[model samples]
Target: VVPGINEIYDPRTKTWSEGPERYFPTYPALFLTQGGEIFYTGSNAGYGPADEGREPGLWDLESNTFTEVGGLRDADQLETSASLLLPPAQEQRFMVLGGGGVGESEESTERTAIIDLTEENPRYRDGPPLPQGTRYLSSVILPDDTVFTSGGSEDYRGRGDSDILKAQFYDPATNSFRPAADPTVGRNYHSEALLLPDGRVATFGSDPLFGDADNTRMGEFEKRIEVYTPPYLHDGREERRPVLGEGPERAAPGETVTFATGQPGRIAEARLMRPSAVTHTTDVEQRSLQLEVRRGAGGVSFTLPEDPSLVPPGWYMLFVSDEEGTPSEATWIQIGEGLAKD
Candidate 1:
């Protein structure tokens, strides 16, 4: 709870200040504003109306304080499934798009909402609905402030489907959203999207869509990592090719690769893709690694442990992320006969 000096609180002094509240308990995501405040959305883990069970809404962070933001009235609403913090223009703003919540009844929703931070308390105004229906998807923020969201699930006309591998982008400048290149590999649950240093979006994770009768999903999880680069991009005068670096061909068995945007203030925890074989070595193994790469560092590297069991001969994908665990570029590499030095 304490980042630096550990001291007990004294109600008598009316100070010692309160502790920083941990908002993310179950896949909760947040973003940092240009004004140095944290913006987040929380979901109910079947706790109560206060937690919403499935209800999703916004939360604010300023001066180490936590305040709730826009939320759905229904306890089962999942409207704010995914979001990204847009760099301040006229005022601070957030692009919240494509999340599934309770529609008419207990059914899922496909609405999009944008939160304008310039306001006193911030306002959530509904945006143009998604081109198609979607739910349980993820998004990323580009240097130009474009938000790209990927595949999700839900039956359209009544046919139950999950692998909705479509993609879309939202631009705040115009207060509108447009479509981006779609991914070849589609996923549902447990999947994530990351923004790469080279201006492309990398996505990894698994599909929650179960197959007919008995096949099940992709062996409990996905080790496949794919990167998506914009077909066209420009800096000022000349065209700029996407320049994300390639990871190790072999990852020294258990080593990991990290990604970063080279921006300082925009730093947070990094996420990685694990091979399905990676089991719980201990209680801690159940969770993802929380490594914060130095801002403006321009790049992040994950040195493989010299241990043999940690990394064996196998191919794996590595992904890095910010504090909210929104993934960046996902580089694919193989781990073969090689030492840490090699």
Candidate 2:
């Protein structure tokens, strides 16, 4: 209902400052693009004009410009949808998941779209579709560079018992979906999935309107929690998982930090995934940045990207993935203006 109004908060100053006169829908799915620009995936939740500010695009706050990106299927049904910055954030790729019709309509779509912003002219391209039409789905970026998505409803607020229990992993490398263990409970409306530091994904909260298909029975908030363990942790691989030891507690951008790993030779890649801050399936901060790894006999070294814009000052989880794409349990690394512990 509000437009041309925005605010920015400074944690250090503990004060709110006036931001650029740009407006966004509630919980807009925006990723911080390079040079202080923001990319909106057009995935959103809650209410507004339903027409205004609904297109996917690169939003430049400095000059007050919006360059729209095309090629999204079911663009009108983006409400309750999910958007994610694809793994290895340097690729600058993003995806929008399934969503429902505008303003309480029962319609939904099983479509997905991906956009690579690195290209000269970035546009959304159709990726693999979901198994069924869903809304309010929750997604978590796994440590192994795959996205674990699960749980949504076919209708708004899971009306008509439309909650979907399907779960799948989307691999960016292959652009395909792999079957994952189905969640026991149906999740719709208020739900979220998060990646744990131990490499497991934890799911929480789902509020359905009704318990049954007829919508006769009143619904209750699901209090139980579920955790998903990816395949990398199993199959006799526990002993072989790369371990990060003796790393700095804090380091500045453009600094090289070394960690002791037993099997440095098998380390194919390392990444720093910003600790996620999400609400209602909208996570603008959830992104992964690949670190250039140099192997040493008993450890490995990761040089943080020189650009502070690429890596905002915050806490991140550093995971080293082996040749088999198996990631180690995360080690905490803080990026800021600080010296490392000798």
Candidate 3:
């Protein structure tokens, strides 16, 4: 945990290379967002001063350099603050939600902040606040482009009787939050949530120190995983669900992509979802984009986003949802030509 060193592993070459050292130590609650650029937030430790400056900043992968972005509403580093990249919109934006404040007081906060990356000088502003102060909660992007947050603790270190069992949904279009179904088990401290290919959300894991198997209070660990079916899935439209078939594995941004579908006329929407990089309630890279679709006799055509800054360069799962909101089995597609790091 001291003297943080950075390293990058090349999956193609099966090799590792030393990267420029970080100014501060990296730990849980720290998050990284990826588009063409990568951004990070949260503190270096549970309770302490933040690395470099307290504000979240961008990291240059090519040069291994870090640049601070200005105008943060809350510059003080907080523990377990949930930072996430919202679904693709006119401009790229990131949201930082509830978390515990720094120092021994370690009080929880309900403040929410936003950063617009498209601006010449990106800065954070106050967004819609949460229903209550929370930390260590899991947030995921839904198929409809909204965000859902569940299970967290009201205090730092997740002490006795601090669990938050309710769930909430954030709608960017409305800039407001509403209530959602709660999970049966609590997910605080070490919990996570990820969107599935079929559009359902799977959540699990919670390891409070004294609640693990080694400790006498085994029930507190929360071993069982749970899957949540969104209201759209239960709306009685299963018979009209679309089915995805063969398609190109990759293409560049703005390319016209075509794919086969069993229910061509029934298809209503096409979307691309980036795989989640989730841990400790922070998933900075999870994103989804709606593609413009045109239905043909035997297949469908869609155009990808023209801006590399919006879609980035990576492998994404493509899904076509029917009018009833049922999504097809995902087909993997890599976006853009691979960038040479060297």
Candidate 4:
């Protein structure tokens, strides 16, 4: 229904504008890169050999055109696959993780791929795979720069019997994955996970259709929300979260930004987290980047990334954290052109 007709809504004018035709019918696995370009990796437009030609593509917001970038390593990963824009790096990379194949009994794939967006001809290469094949999982980036993937099904429509309980942490530094603490609830289709300001992750929702029906142990939908406290919070140390005070409401790239903090000595990290836009196991806009923090006279100072591609021109929630991984209350700041010059 989407590729057939595309429309853009303007909040200021409160009007809708018809856009160019889409390259393909996109689904949940759509993400926005640091360069302000949109990319699509997956879709729910049925499955078969015909889908092999369905490759990933990029959308130019200004020109209202879609261009095919590169094809996935495994074409079967075109549905229910989780896609995310990796944290700010020298080269922009987008990752696509586990998802089901074409059939109900078909096993899910643990294979993953990373597309280098910085390249003039972007293409995907083999990346680190998951610990195991999973679909419908919630992936959230921790403040420590690790990706945390939680509950999902091991097989398609197998949530009743193949619910994954344990969580996994993907370390980009080593290009490997390790297990993390498990949550009580089994989050599959329709579930989501988000990073909190305090460095903890909150997971919510589950397949209510099966949960509400079939009054059985396995078929019940999960209505209760679960919060996961990372290992940093309970490392047998006193909790000391940085308290952010006055700071500029807007900033520019390469600018030296200062903020007042009551616990300057405890301030060890500063970061910018883009607001989350999640639905159906897909969240393209959820990204976090570390800022260089230095102790100053009355507070702390940090330089924003010099590259606009790293910190795209938009609004971001700035947070300061201590050594124990406790983050301060988020302060909204506008970067680049969204705000007027002072």
Please give each candidate's TM-score: 0.53, 0.95, 0.83, 0.83
What TM-score does structure 2 among the candidates reach?
A: 0.95
Best TM-score among the predictions, by candidate number:
2
lDDT tens digits by residue: candidate 1, 57-101: 333333444556653322234432555444322244555454444
C-alpha lDDT of residue 289 in model 1: 23
Question: Cα-based RMSD of the predictions, in order?
Answer: 13.3, 1.6, 4.3, 3.7
Off by over 4 Å in 2: 1-4, 338-342
Candidate 4 residue spans exceeding 4 A from truth: 43-53, 61-71, 89-91, 103-105, 208-218, 249-256, 263-266, 303-315, 322-326, 334-342
lDDT of the candidates, in the order given? 0.47, 0.86, 0.72, 0.72
The all-Cα superposition gives candidate 3 an RMSD in Å to the true structure of 4.3
Q: Candidate 1: lDDT over CA atoms? A: 0.47
Ranking by lDDT: 2, 3, 4, 1
Worst 10 residues of 1 by lDDT: 278-287
Report the number of backbone clashes for model 1.
13
Candidate 4 residue lDDT tens string, 1-342: 544466777766999998665544345465656666677766442333434435678878788777776656666655667777776443467778877765454467777777888787987787887777877778887766778888877766444467678798877778788889988887776788988766678999877334432336546566899999877666553255567888888888778788887767888888788877777777867878778799977789878776676776788888777876666767788888344323
Better-scoring candidate (TM-score), 2 or 4: 2
Candidate 1's TM-score reads: 0.53
Q: Looking at model 2, which ten-residue stretch has the lowest summed lDDT?
A: 333-342
* Candidate achieving higher TM-score, 1 or 3: 3
